[model samples]
Target: MSNRSYSSQPKSVVIVGAGIIGATLGYHISRRAGMTVTLLERDLPGAGASGHSFAWVNGFGKDPRAYHTLNRRSLDMWYRLAHQLDADIGIHYGGEMRWENDPRRATQLRQRVRQIQTWGYPCRLITRAEMLALEPHLHPGDVLAASLSEADIHVETDTFIDVCLRRACEAGAVVYSQTAVTGFVVRDGSIAAVKTVDAEFPCDVVVLASGVQTTELASLAQVQIPQQQSPGIVMKTTPCVEVLHNVAVIHAPAIDEKHQHLHLRQLSDGSLRIGQGTQEGINRDDSQQQADALLDRARAYLPTIGDARAIPTPVGYRPMPLDGFPVLGFTEAVPNLYVALMHSGVTLAPLVGEMATLEIVDDVRVDWFASYRPERFSVRSSG
Candidate 1:
């Protein structure tokens, strides 16, 4: 860690992207006394994965102590952020319940539950009777084992982005909507200005928080940040009478290769948000077909959603790194350029913003972020 203190003089910082990560970073950094922040969005805020995310904020499946620890920390940070912003952000801490159908997989699931519990995660196995008692609407069909963790949170991501942006704007951060970063002007091996379609904005530092487009923007600065553009489809239903008991149900995929994993949760407005695995070559017709299929599967578990209609929504790409973890912190090739890209943007947004701001404004290196540096990918490319 570097022993650097916060600068007294204000730094002109430009952030490219107005998604949840960028917006939250702006909000946190702008709260400091000596920072001039500007957030640029090609589209409106939350127009990317943040908008379409299933938005379940939990560290249930994240592995490696460092990654899971960060997520666990962010889970607490979300409540604090919501309190500070005085906004609802649609956060529900009703917890999550997951079960396995196959008897063999149920044994593995029990082992996995023990592993996570040993790691200090709040998860425990429950019988089918207990699972049904917790969520009375669930149809427990041969569920050999199930786990429930009350530490999970559900969010309405678009509202969260809006609240973060609003607070950042209140703190004097300038926001530019529909303005895209076309290129970068580098000087003395450092970013000097961000070139947009209409004009160039001089900045002391540039933070690239763009999701799938992070790779394209980094290339302009001669930095390679590779990302896997995984396509995910989320199906929303028209508002109906509440049938779900406010608990999220996440089921293991069928072993026979005939059923896709199903994750279902209820929104604040009595509508159901159901999602499944990524469909690589999904087209318009295919999207509807997939949505119908997911709904049919959902009906098997929650019979109330059978009458609900599927609303048409565009699919969003998850900005997953090549290794399926986050790529955060500064780049070695470009000293003044920082990148924040990850798959669970919604779950990790607030904490990343707070930590990234500390590193950027105070020049302090966070020891935990050492593993996620962009240099990891650089080493991969050279090898």
Candidate 2:
């Protein structure tokens, strides 16, 4: 709306993707004074990994550092937005039960509790009996000990942004769907316009958040960003008549199926979500068969999950930066261009959006994001 087209708002913004992170960033930053937001999406909102996701607002699983800090901040912001937007992200923050195998693992979980508490997040240690009481279907043999952090939420990314994006549009942002940004028009070192198959949208600033496709857009801006894809899949069951109320994750190493880490969670609609396994490669193919094997194996970890009404397999590619940690903020080489890419997106989306919004619109330092600059690898190479 203002003539200052050099930021997320105030300046016209052409966001390349409309996933959760991009939409949230657009939604939050568009509400600022003196700004216009123009969101460009290759597909419908939440269609990408944002839509096909585990949607766990997991503050407990992140490593204990800036990753944890960023995730925790995002969790706080999500709860705030749950109230502010009054939209459904299927936010259930009751708590997650992390199952343990033995005293040693239980001790390790105690350490996790100690670590989070040391950072000022409270968590409760529960016994096997307590866990069974919470998630009755959990195999008593599979779970030895557990940790329950009542701070986080379980979410469904599919419909999470319907309201936020709608609110963003209502508040003056223009979202172009099914219209991909073929490329960008760069003048000098700043972005001049965003080109698509339809029309050229001239803008002062551009945010590249096209998920796994970010590398392509980065190339358009003349930045050789190295982003890799990691595949992890989750299976969902049709709504259960008595789906357990809380999230349940087993910690024991021993399992009935081939050895791997496994997790179990009950969706608000009474469906069960199960995830386990990490596959790293450039796989464009959906590993439905491979995931089915894992899900079959996962049923043994939690027997009740196999009593499915219907099993829907979902595949996800975690965008692991060659340098672990997300890539965010403006490039040291290009002006008016910002990026947001992450492997653990839902955990980092809210913070990345809020912080990146803080960086792009307000010209703030974004010191918290020092760990995630894409240029750092290039700088390190030259150094």
TM-score of each: 0.92, 0.87
What are the root-mean-square deviations of the candidates from the true structure over C-alphas? 2.9, 3.7
CA shift at 321, candidate 1, in angstroms? Answer: 1.3
- The lDDT for every candidate, in the order shown, is 0.81, 0.71
* Candidate 2 lDDT score at position 381: 48
Residues 1-383 of candidate 2: C-alpha lDDT, one tens digit per residue? 22233543436777888988888888888888777899999889888877666666766757747678778888778777778777675676666667666667667778888888788675778887787677776565655557777776667676667777888888899998899889877777677889999799887778888888888788877786786666666666676554454653333344544555555566667776766642232334345565566556656556666456436465666666766578887777676778888876876777787778878787776788877777775544454
Best prediction by lDDT: 1
Candidate 1, poorest ten consecutive residues by summed lDDT? 1-10
Candidate 2 ranges beyond 4 A from true positions: 1-9, 102-104, 248-257, 278-306, 309-314, 379-383
Model 2: lowest-lDDT 10 consecutive positions: 277-286
